[model samples]
Target: MQHPAVPELAHTHTRPIHWVATATAIAGVVALSSLLQPKPATAAQSATPDAKPAPTTAPSTADVDFPLDCGPEQALVVKKATGDLDGDGTPETVAVVHCDAPMGTPPDGVYVLTHNPGHTHARVVATLIDPKARNTVTGLTVTDGAVLATLLGYSTADVPSCCPDVKDSARWQWKDNTFVRSTPAGARSI
Candidate 1:
């Protein structure tokens, strides 16, 4: 039955073309939306007059003279890890260094290096393991504001330099404006 008030609407009938057109328009909208995505949100706050920007780069091990007296040989950084060890915004580098020796195993010194915001060179802030300890750092890492290391040492002076008889695990954490050393576990004979 046709009503006099409104003629039969042609668009009211479902057609294949109408479906195709509607689907294409929806696809175009989705594609456009993907390309117009908003920038990712960051927790970083905008720079203020008194606020100092956090350091982006960690301290470098190269060129920084360590406290170890290598004498004629050069100091070599064997392993290094970087992290925010002092709860400061800036990161520090934990380096396992030893003298470049051509022969027997050389003792390693673990040092913490920090670079000042505007400084070009990094300076050694703390010495975790002194070379005089006659220990070799087998593994070094900085995690959760703590410096961890596996050290190999001689049981006595009679122990040959080529071989270490004792194995020890060490951890250092920043506390009270100083790095405090703690033996996490008991040393074992290797």
Candidate 2:
């Protein structure tokens, strides 16, 4: 056979030591690249220093002590809706709360809650329905900065608490620094 012009290469045959050295070099490159990543990119600019930060989150109902005397039972939130009710940029929460009764129907109390951006606790701004009225909220919603509710009430004191004899649809709007309540129509007997 004719003599080859070039000699055989040593790396053509990979030994255990060659594999170990190659693995170490690859690991080193990966570790070095991870430590040299670029900063994250953003599209929006930062806010001005003096302007008030827009409130992002609506107030929560937890830890809010509603104006209701449950006696031995605690106040429980059944339904809630959030919206900007007072024409303010920040949103407010409307909560329907009632006593945690084990037996009969308990009257519900509807309250409006507002919390400043940095405040720790949310305060009650308005009480739409008091528990003393003995009314149960069948449906509640906040739409177009208005609080609308379907209320179930009694026609007279003789009516039993278990059965409400009157059904009314009520709407409350913020006007003149107070919530003005107006009924779309007269209460109907159920």
Candidate 3:
């Protein structure tokens, strides 16, 4: 059977069609993979607001202030103490930090900061944050490689500032690289 020669039909199955077909197939595969593959987590999607970060350096060696300097607008200082409790041939500064909330007598916390090696600034060694409600460190002393923090707890919110109904003390020892709390003078732990 003799057929008529067609100039346009010869190019129909040429390299251009093959290239177009290959490109379409690649595009289809890419689209299908994008739909089926698990989405990569973005910063906002994976971010955890309540996540506490692991300590990068030893608390006894970190160069931070005891009060944490949480910015003046948010917090304030309530009490301060100075002595050597880490047995590192140096004195440390202990401070009680109080947050500024819209209530009567904010809760207070305790921290220990050491004087910098060059006497330039103080660096934090340990922290006892948010010890009790409406309470602050009544007294603190660093001796015998121990930190004796006297915390005064209040029975009611409307109690006097000086006389707390309950007087509690926490003792911390700088063991190895961290602070370990021990039993106080009249405390029994289970």
- What are the per-residue Cα lDDT tens digits for candidate 3 across 1-190? 6766954575556687788989999999999988898877777545499754433322342334445334454656666666556665556666777766565655677877755454445666566655445566667776776777766677677777656677777888888788888856575221
lDDT winner between candidates 1 and 3: 1
Show model 3 residue runs off by greater than 4 Å: 1-74, 100-103, 117-119, 131-134, 154-165, 185-190
lDDT of 2 by residue, 1-83 (tens): 98779998888898999999999999999999999999787895667887667776789998887899999999999999999
TM-score of 2: 0.70
Looking at candidate 1, what is the lDDT of residue 166? Answer: 92
Best by lDDT: 2
Winner on TM-score between 1 and 3 is: 1
Q: Deviation in angstroms for 170 in model 1?
A: 0.5
TM-score of 3: 0.48
Ranking by lDDT: 2, 1, 3
Backbone clash tally (model 3)? 1
Give the alpha carbon lDDT tens digit for every residue of 60-174 in model 1.
Answer: 8878989988889999999999999999778999999999998888899998999855677899989999999999988888889999898899989998888888998988999
For model 3, what is the C-alpha lDDT against the true structure? 0.64
Whole-structure CA lDDT of model 1: 0.88
